[model samples]
Target: MDKLRRVLSGQEENEERGLTSQVLDASSLSYSTRVKWFFICFVAGILLSILGTALLFIPGGGFKLFAVFYTLGNLAALGSTCFLMGPLKQLKRMFEPTRLIATIVMLLCFVLTLCAVFWWDKKPLAILFCVLQFLAMTWYSISYIPFARDAVMKCFTTCLS
Candidate 1:
């Protein structure tokens, strides 16, 4: 309870692991670095997700493997979005609102996935939700590409200099 309280209040510290604060501050990293990491994570997530889809085409009992890849990809994408939020929020003026929308879309996808998996009849709705989720993810990724591109250029220039 105490630990939770401290973490919630943003006062937690773990010195042994060399962690200074429990709270994450986006300003701690350079904008370009943040963008680069975001890009890497996003690409990884997309690749994993595509691989998961490919697994779905397998003829026999690939559900488990498909689930594994799908879950991993989703988690990666979600994690990347969250990780970039701090830096993007600080560096970009338009990120906050769009982030909110993306979050909501993901949440809806979650609910729909659960409903579709358990209820059987709602599978169509789940399919629709999946499409919506894909669009949201695509939009979120595309919107942030500029920041990552700028960061790459900055890094390239600095290396040349």
Candidate 2:
């Protein structure tokens, strides 16, 4: 944090700093870079979800469970993005992470896929293979890196008083 103190207190000039430095404090981050990772993940999720919609158009065929699950997951995510997240309130951690409203939809998708394979109709070997694809998609969707990056950056601090 001494680097930040240096930058903030003007103990060292901004021209002497490098972009590659890890300690940015609050002022050194550019607006675009600050939010870029979230935007990329958001766009990628949308595109993967559109492919799920296209699967619905196939005739008498495959991926019904997959398409339905993906649709529900995306819609729930979109709703949470709209309603759940607000200006990062550290004091209100207890009011968040409500599964039925936010995270349970994705969990439901995973459980239902496995249940469908077992109880609905385990017809042929070919059917199992197609169902396997759905399971893969659900697993991939569920396995996500929730945070973009480390929340804080720290570097050399030997020089500060």
Candidate 3:
């Protein structure tokens, strides 16, 4: 009960601490502040993603621009969640057994998309990787909602049958 009150009031525990703990406490934003920043980052991420998609219509180097912006947007959106759950906790949750594969695949696709666009200069490959990234990100995201993954799988199976 006391801990919950502290959390709700955005106060840290008055426990014995070390330098690292002190630093983290000093840098930690209040709950409301964290939520505000999270919203800002998430909205910017969505806007960037929309702009990137619109850029797909432009000729010559458009795909490259789209890939970069899209990847950055996804990264920003992912990072925004860290504000709600601190970065360490977010990382731990991301690597948990239930979502581990989805997380890894999503990150890998992000890297591959940029590599295909900038290094390989292969528009088709970049597009393919971007599609994969979208799918992976969707899977990873639904993991956070209870039974969402199961529902998605059931829907796909029913469609196939």
Q: 46-150 in candidate 1: lDDT tens per residue?
A: 788788778767876444344456656765776665456563453353346746676567656756654664565454565566667677665555556667546
For all predictions, the C-alpha RMSD in Å is: 11.9, 17.3, 5.7
Q: What is the lDDT of residue 19 in candidate 1?
A: 43
If the candidates were sorted by their TM-score against the true structure, best first, what order would they fall in?
A: 3, 1, 2
Candidate 1's displacement at residue 18, Å, is: 16
- Regarding lDDT, does 1 or 2 come out ahead? 1
Q: In model 2, which regions exceed 4 Å deviation?
A: 1-31, 59-61, 68-102, 114-161
Clashes of each: 0, 0, 0
Q: Model 2: which ten-residue window has the lowest total lDDT?
A: 147-156
Cα lDDT, all candidates = 0.63, 0.45, 0.90
- C-alpha positional error of residue 3 in candidate 3 after TM-score superposition, expressed in Å: 20
| Tens-digit per-residue lDDT, 1-161, candidate 3 | 54578889999677767998876777689999999999999998888888899899899868878999999889998899999998989999999999999999999999999999889888889889889988998999999999999999999999999
Clashing pairs in model 3?
A: none
**Residue-by-residue lDDT tens digits, candidate 2, 1-161:** 77679878878765655654433333454545535644654555566556655764666644555455454445443333322233233114323553222234444444555455446644353245435544544433333334311211112233342
Lowest summed lDDT across 10 adjacent residues in model 3 is found at: 12-21
The residue pairs in collision within model 1 are none
